[model samples]
Target: MTKQPESSVARPHPGALALGVLGELLITAGLVLALFVGYSLWWTDLVADARAERAGDRLRRAWAAPAAAPPGQAAPAPTYRPGADGIGFLHVPAMGRDYSVLIRLGTGSEVLDGGVAGVYREPYRAAMPWDASGNFALAAHRDGHGAKFHDLDEVGRGAAVVVETRDHWYVYRVDGTLPRASKFDTGIIAPVPEGSGYPGPGRYITLTTCTPVYSSRFRMAVWGSLVRVDPVDARRTPPPELRTS
Candidate 1:
């Protein structure tokens, strides 16, 4: 018999080849999705946390530096400038004893990338802690970019939310929470937030983050009212509320 041609051997069906290609593509897509999840859950946090630390240090240094006096005047007092490089620090003992993060002025990617909360600048800027009657509103990431408020829901009613400034520690008591609210519900941070039980204008603090753990479809808000303002002491000791809880 003449030598048989190898080309005559049976080959895979076209359908089989197509299926193989499709399988490879699916695998590649799955891998890409996993990598994205990893980046969102881990890598972004590491980078953001580092940046936050640097920002916090800068704020501390600024506070430590004394202001220069005029040629023939008393030395200017050290101050906490709202729109300055660092506005203040937020402390939530209910989240954790060390759960303190810096608060920046603008709620933009640039400000939030530092892994800290940012105050709204349009329609309603955050009222200063010293403001007699206004809302000190803030927003932070719940799932990425440091996730400073990741456990915001853990804060129970009557928990303490403290804001530390250059001159004072503004203590607020958690009154209630809106488990899920539309992101467009600007009233959550209003001077007198509806449904917050404040009834009228008062010193208030509103902490907002994305809801449902990792989704931004809705918002989670924690509302509190300023109970008192304590002058910062030399030791910077935590207030009784924070110290106890």
Candidate 2:
């Protein structure tokens, strides 16, 4: 028997092709939206919460000891105490490093403002707190709002910066600057210099950070001797001098 001619099938309609493309576009858009939402929840929104929690933890740890008095005081001051025993705070006036939230050296703080937030400074904890004595080298970001020490270079030699603990304030002079093309072997941080050209002295405060505002190609070191240390009560007044009670 002769085979019947096979029937030809019609091609897909143009409307069907258009519908397929539309379906794919909708799926892609949905996926992108989902990714964005996930990132906001995981990174952007939650990051601040984590950081603020850490800052609070650092603050709480300070003053953990029995309240103590500043040096030369006969006894611990009433209602005034030392930084949570061992940890401390560093304050700077002109560089805006003052009034900054303090955490242990090398520890970080929460981002208070905008894009310039959330960087942890590298600190030398062994050095005495500003209120005490010895060298205190603290490093912060050089640029961005997070760049904590961005304007530190602007400080002229003989200018002053203050470091405050729960108990006292230490005044540091901006005596000199150390320029380096490359970072030195700074693993040996101390109450004494490990030979980065800083002289071992009675008391020194060193400030270090990456230079050129936003670049880390070279580190800029600005440091000076601790001119004096005194009870925070002596001169811890804010520029505005509002009642802090």
Candidate 3:
């Protein structure tokens, strides 16, 4: 008997095959993007937290065991020496009830990447809290590297930003804030930070971070004035302002 004509097999259209491959590629790309975000947001924080803790511990240890005074010289003040590789802790009540982190010397990534705030040490170098008259400027990451200043916007007038040293706690009260500022506005960190609403030379603390969340195009500044200085107690308890939110 004559064989029946062989049935023709149907093949997937070229367009459909191409679309299937494209779908797979798109899914892969999406997954990679998600992983990167997770790493930036969460993993980096984890790594930075560890580094910060180590640095904080070293600071505490140094304070616990200070260098002996030289002969015929009075003991050095219990303060973190500027121009040295000094690192101190900072506490902001409005940032968080338990907000505390080390403040490093420079605003470079080397220091800020440790999940701590860094003082501007370049062209617009910042003054330490211990300075008698000058702006104590600080910079921190707003969204990554522990996001130390992420909640800076929430800090309102009258909130406290306290810097902790071996012996003293420099307490500053929020006076004003510029929600947005140009990134190149170095004057904001000047001894008499302009646009800060303060009239003239006075003790000030300026907290700056990348603004608009998840972007570094602009900056946000929180300006405060020295309200008081509290001596560290034997128990190392924080000041009243840092006791609550």
Candidate 4:
């Protein structure tokens, strides 16, 4: 029998094949980008918050424990020394009623990613909250890793920023704000921060973070003066600034 010529099946065009591959690659890339965003914005916050909570608990436990003193000597005052845990808690009432974050040493990602505000130690040594006449500069993430300063813009002039230590609550009142500053503006953390409307040295608190939301193209700072220091009572009641309705 004469063999009928087998009908040739049409092959996909090269252009169509290339387009299909490109589409698939684009989809994969989009998925990866989305996953990264989710991890950065959500997962990281969860992990950091958990770590911060544990650290905070440990700090509170330590505060509750009675200190040992020599047989005839009184217990010494609480002094801050850099440790793996933390030094204090930051309370920005303008941020929210429950806004609080542990404060640790160093502004590195390793320290900030733990969901805590970091004290600036490079370029300029940030004065501790208890210091008499220097800037207590601090940095925290604005978007992820607890986003401690996400609502920093809301902290207008006269707003309160309190730091809670083992012995005292250092209250600061917002006085100046640089909505946008160069990331390299180290002077903003100086003893008398530049461009913060301060003329000379004094007790100040500077809160800094990435500006314009998720983008880190610039930095934003909120400057404040030491308003008062309230000693911690046995009940540990929050200061008036924090108790406002």
| Top-TM-score candidate index | 4
* After superposition, candidate 2 runs with Cα above 4 Å error: 1-86, 97-101, 107-125, 130-133, 185-199, 234-245
Residue pairs in candidate 3 whose N, alpha carbon or C atoms collide under 3 angstroms: none
Off by over 4 Å in 1: 1-8, 71-84
Per-model clash counts, in order, read 0, 6, 0, 0
lDDT of 4: 0.90
Model 4, residue 73: C-alpha shift (Å): 2.9
Please, what is the whole-model Cα lDDT of each candidate in the order they appear? 0.86, 0.54, 0.85, 0.90
lDDT of 3 by residue, 1-245 (tens): 99899899899999999999999999999999999999998998889889888878877888787567999897876544332345678899787788998887888787787798888876766777878888989998987788899899999888888999888999999999999989998888888988988999888999999989999999989999999998988788988886754
**Per-prediction TM-score to the true structure, in the order listed:** 0.90, 0.53, 0.92, 0.94
Model 4 clashing residue pairs (backbone): none
Tell me how far candidate 2 lies from the true structure as C-alpha RMSD in angstroms. Answer: 8.9
Candidate 1's C-alpha lDDT? Answer: 0.86
Candidate 1 has its poorest 10 consecutive residues by lDDT at 75-84
Error of 1 at 173 (Å): 0.2
Output the number of the lDDT-best candidate: 4
Q: Which candidate model has the greater TM-score, 3 or 4?
A: 4
Better by lDDT, candidate 4 or 2? 4
Kindly list the per-residue Cα lDDT of model 1 for residues 1-245, writing each as its tens digit: 99986776689999999999999999999999999999998999999999889889987887787657888898664444433477789999888877899988877777776698888776776677787789999988988889999999999899999999877899999999999999888888888887798889889999999989889899989999999999988777878876853
RMSD of 4: 1.7
Candidate ordering by lDDT (highest first): 4, 1, 3, 2
Clashes of 4: 0
